[model samples]
Target: MSERLLHLGHEVVALVRPEAAEVVGAYEGRIGDLLDPRTLTAAVTPDIDAVIDVATPLGDQAADAAAIAALTAPLVGTGRGFVYTSGVWVLGATEDRTADEQSPVDAIEIVRYRPAIERQVLALADEAVRATVIRPGLIYGHGGGIPALLVDLARKFGAPRIVGDLGVRWPMVYIEDLAELYVRVVTNASAGTLWHGVAHPAVAVKDLAAAAGAVAGVTTEPVVWPVTEAADELGAPFAAALALDQSVSGAAARDQLGWRPDGPNPIVEMLDGSYR
Candidate 1:
């Protein structure tokens, strides 16, 4: 995201820990830590044109709320843009239905606090801040993210293993595509609006596992790892999230912000592109 912003002629300032200062490269690096709310006070200064809260602080909701308060207090009534990053897990299992931006949330246990945080961020629009919430699906690309975990599992077991039932599906977005949506929202979106950053809305987990197996040089048919056992290995909340079945739409982003996700197919990318 920083690179994209810089390539577009926008100045980039990254908030990082002291150890990561050198990693910011051409962008200015502000010393801070998301897990420590007090350190985030200097993240948004008067010269900052916009603020994007993409940091997820290890499920520490209190720290996240405090950090948000500190970041936005300086921008109140300034009409500056504030983008908060959330995830589709807040929508929970959509079952056979496809959820849009306006869908009523049936958030699961893991993200129960997210709805309140999203509401807090959206309410800032009334304070003259152009606050918007972006909910991205399972972000995958560059041989990273949750998909890579499946590849790891395939290598570990010498066979592909999927969590929960075979019918489970996930919403997906390429990393670069999701980043482009962030750029659009930062420069173009109206106040108080929400956007879904998904591309492929219903990717089957079995297919993903098979691709992962192929990547691991194993063509064995994927097996279902029960959610209970998965929880033992991957934590209860995240395992439940992996087991969720959801379909989400990014139409609002396309129709409103003119976002074009021209990325390669996720499964194909895993099989023959980045993940390879």
Candidate 2:
């Protein structure tokens, strides 16, 4: 997202820990800690036009809320843009049906606290801040997301494996495509609006595992590892979330912000592209 912003002539300033000051090299870096909200007030100075909260306070809901309050306190009545990142897990299982931006949130245990924070960010729109909430789907690409974890499992177990039933499906978005959506939302989306950053609404887990198996040079059929067994390795909450069946649409972003997500198909990308 920073790369795209820089390409479009937007100045980027990243809030970082003191030790990681060099990470933001050419771009301006302001030292702050999400866990310690006191250091954050300086980040949203009057010169800053927009603030994007993409940092997760691990699973610490209280810290996240506090960090948000500190960041937006400086922007109230300024009408500056503020974008908060949330995820589709908050929508819970959609089975075979597709959920849009307005779907009622039935958040799973893993992200039960996120909807409240999302609401907190939206309420700021009433305070004259252009606050928007974005819910991105299972992010895949750059050879580094959840899909890559499956590839590692395939190589380790000598075959592809999915957390639960092979029939389960996941909403997906390529990293670069999701980044472009952020550019649109930060620059043009209206206050209090919500956007779903999904590309493929429902990609079957069976197909995804097969792609991972192919990447591992395994020709055998993919395995459906039971959720209980997966929970032992990947904590219970996350295991349940990975096994969730969701079909989410990104139409709001496409129709409202003219977002065009043309990234490579995820299965193909895993088998022969970035993940390979």
Q: Which candidate wins on lDDT? A: 2
Cα lDDT of all candidates, in order? Answer: 0.91, 0.92
Write out the backbone clash pairs for model 1: none
How far does residue 138 in candidate 1 sit from its true spot (Å)? 0.5
Scanning candidate 1 in windows of ten residues, the lowest lDDT window is 55-64
Candidate 1's residue-wise lDDT over 134-228, tens digit each?
A: 99999999999988999999999988998889999999999999999999999999999999999999999999999999999988999999999
Model 1 RMSD vs true structure: 1.1
> 269, model 2: CA deviation in Å?
0.7
Q: Write out the backbone clash pairs for model 2.
A: none
Query: Which lDDT tens digits does candidate 2 get at residues 8-41?
Result: 9999999999899988878999999987788898
**TM-scores of the models, in the given order?**
0.97, 0.98
Q: After aligning candidate 1 to the native by TM-score, how far in Å is the CA of 67 from where it should be?
A: 0.7
Model 2, 19: alpha-carbon shift in Å?
Answer: 1.7
- Predicted structure 2: clash tally: 0
Pick the TM-score winner. Answer: 2
Q: Provide the lDDT at 187 for model 1.
A: 93
